[model samples]
Target chain A: MSTRELKHAGLNLQQTDPKTHEEAESRVFGFWVFLMSDAVLFALLFATYGVMLSGTAGGPGTQNVYEMKSAFIETLLLLSSSFTFGMASLAMKYEGKASRISVWLAVTLILGLGFLGMEMHDFVKMIGEGATPERSGFLSSFFALVSTHGLHVLGGSIWIVVMLVQLSVFGVTPAVKTRILRLGLFWHFLDIIWVGIFTIVYLQGLTP
Target chain B: MNQEDRAEYRRELRSYIIGLIAALVLTAASFATVHWRLFSAPTGILIAIYLLALVQIIAHFRYFLHIDLRKSARDDLQLILFSTMIVLLMVGGTLIVLFNLKSRMF
Candidate 1:
């Protein structure tokens, strides 16, 4: 297929040789499927959180525990990380030097770590205030949903580090290229989930 | 990279920039709507917030995920839509049944 014809979901795979390109195409598609299933998992968690919103059992509720400023900052961090990951993908595709890709990925990793730190801080403050997950169903579900997303960010950060090492060792082979593309999808996907969390958990919590 | 590749790089870069700007705007607006009490009622604020979030999600899907209605991208789109449907069914049913039972018991 021509380059134009090879242009499809996730990332463009046409930069590789034909054999590797074909392999990467299916692999990226499979990753997309995995992402969708993961979406369903998050959706269920969201639903559970929604159901338990009223079950605070006299513990700290949304307004009492959530700080909008912190959540907003976290949102900014994750969103910027998503954009940075996009730049990494671009560097992978267009730039000859692997250093460019590594730079972008490093920036993204920092942003991801920043997000995790802020979220953990929020959790720490909430728990310090006696809003532990064991305190109520609401807090339990809230922790479950938000922490799952946080763990995903943590996992993505580790993947970013691994990809950095792979880039040094493999030097942007078709395999490494496809892996980075999949990483981009995962990173961006986490940002999308954060959008949901800030909207439903944070914004909705502060609505009243 | 060659000139054409550089041009393509700029194009993709533009998409990411656009996505970032759109997401920032949406997120800021959502927070501002609540912080400033833009809407007098809680329901109004919730609706406005959710609508903005929906738009931002679509923006992420388009620019970040590279999902569109193009023929080449349709398969992934279809999978996402299908997953969304299943999610709605499962989550919606859970809510409906649980809330119904809660009302009956209490």
Candidate 2:
């Protein structure tokens, strides 16, 4: 396939080695299937959240618990990390330098970690403010949706560490390259979901 | 690779950067709508926020995930469209049913 065609198909064209291109293409396509299904899961959670938005049970409402500044910072961190991961993929494909890829990956990892840290602090602050999930239905769904996304970010972070190790030990093999491309898709997909969360859950909550 | 291939790679990289900028701006707008109360009515603000989010989602899908309606991506696009349909049905149904039940109980 031409580079443009490959990109259109959502497959990275950086790994142009004829031998493994076919396998990588199928693998990435399969991963996309998984991601679409995952989207359904998040959609369901979001729906549940919408249903429970008013179920405060006399507990603290969204305005009392949500911190807009923290949420905004988290958004910036995750979005920037997505951009950095794209750079990592670019380094892997265009530069074809394992060291350069590793550098970008490390930067992405730090940004991911920063996002998680801020999220954890936000959760702690909420709990400290008596906004525990068990305190009300609204809080329950809030925790469920946001925590599920957090778990996904945690999983992606672990995968990044493992991939970094793989890169060092195995170098930029076809297998590693394909894995990085898939990770990039997964990371970007999570950011898309976060946009929904911050807009629907946080921004709407703070709107008055 | 040839010079043409190199140029294509550069173009792809630039697209990703552009996507990053667009996403950031959308996020900022979402925050601004809430913080500044750009709209006097709460419902108006809500509608604006949702519209902004929908656009940002499409931006991410096209620029970051590279899923588009081009010939090569037709299958993937079909799958996404189908999944979106199911999600809307399920989620919309849940809201209607549950909200109706709550109203009846009250």
Candidate 3:
């Protein structure tokens, strides 16, 4: 009759032990594992950085034109978006209000879009400034590494829009719930990678 | 879960937020030195910032991730350690190969 007694009884049914929320929690665990794997991809890039840093040749080095202020703005935008995503996930889980969850997701999507747009703009400006990948080995690797990340963010934003559409038409069925659960891990994982970029590429690029 | 456990989770969440913010601030400060030169060699400063940034990233994994180092159970810790080792081998191995090729080629 009591809560403890109920839980103990619930445990007897292994299949029914975990509620939908409990199922969702395990997805988070799986996502963490995925992030660890993705970290390896980044580690490869970092190693590349270590190797090719001095390969910049006599061409324009990082500071010859990496606008620190612009980089800062981009960093702030991405970091703030990460917080917005946290808010969205929390709203979805705790509030269980469909409309509000969508609203938070929309807000998160907008911020995410803004971050990627700025990055794209930055890439164009860099190229226009004659800092294209063909200029040097360093530039080639920089473009490859940084642009891959931007593309990932772009992909994630598109996925968000698709999920929003799903939530409205189908409502939060078990499938939709599980998808959101996995996406939460993914969105946060990207944010973690962004933090790495903001530090290694954006911050370090300004030095010297 | 019990009230005590929920409260502990909340505390953990707060600590993660604090740590993340501090990392962000230090990260920004490290590079915001564009207006002034704290170090003479750009290469040295760049490497220093990169190393620091890596530390900040691992900090996020530890706190926000809840991947406890103390794995009284086999599943979580074993998975994490195995994955980490594999990743390290791949990345470190790639670095050696690529850099050597880079040295020889161009």
Q: What TM-score would each prediction reach against the true structure?
A: 0.96, 0.96, 0.77
Tens-digit lDDT string for candidate 1 (B1-106): 6677667677778999999999999999999999999989899999999999999999999999988888878888898899889989999998999999889998
TM-score of chain A of each: 0.95, 0.95, 0.85
Q: After aligning candidate 2 to the native by TM-score, how far in Å is the CA of A181 from where it should be?
A: 1.0
lDDT of 3 by residue, B39-96 (tens): 6777766666666666766665554443445432235557667877887788778878
Local accuracy by lDDT, each model: 0.89, 0.89, 0.66
Candidate 1: tens digits of C-alpha lDDT, residues A1-208: 6334555533455555677777787888899999999999999999999899999898888999989999999999999999998888877776646899999999999999999999989999899999999999999999999999999999999999999999999897878888899999999999999999999999999877
- Candidate 3 chain A has its poorest 10 consecutive residues by lDDT at A6-15
Per DockQ, what order, best first?
1, 2, 3
Kindly give the stretch of ten consecutive residues in candidate 1 chain A with the minimal lDDT sum: A2-11
Candidate 2 vs candidate 3, TM-score winner? 2
lDDT of 2 at A54: 95
Clashing pairs in 2: none
Q: Of all true interface contacts, what fraction is found in model 1?
A: 0.89
Model 1 TM-score, 2 decimals:
0.96
Model 1 ranges off by over 4 Å: A9-16
The residue pairs that clash in candidate 3, if any, are A208-B42
How good is the docking of model 3, by CAPRI class? acceptable
User: CA lDDT of B68 in candidate 1?
Assistant: 86
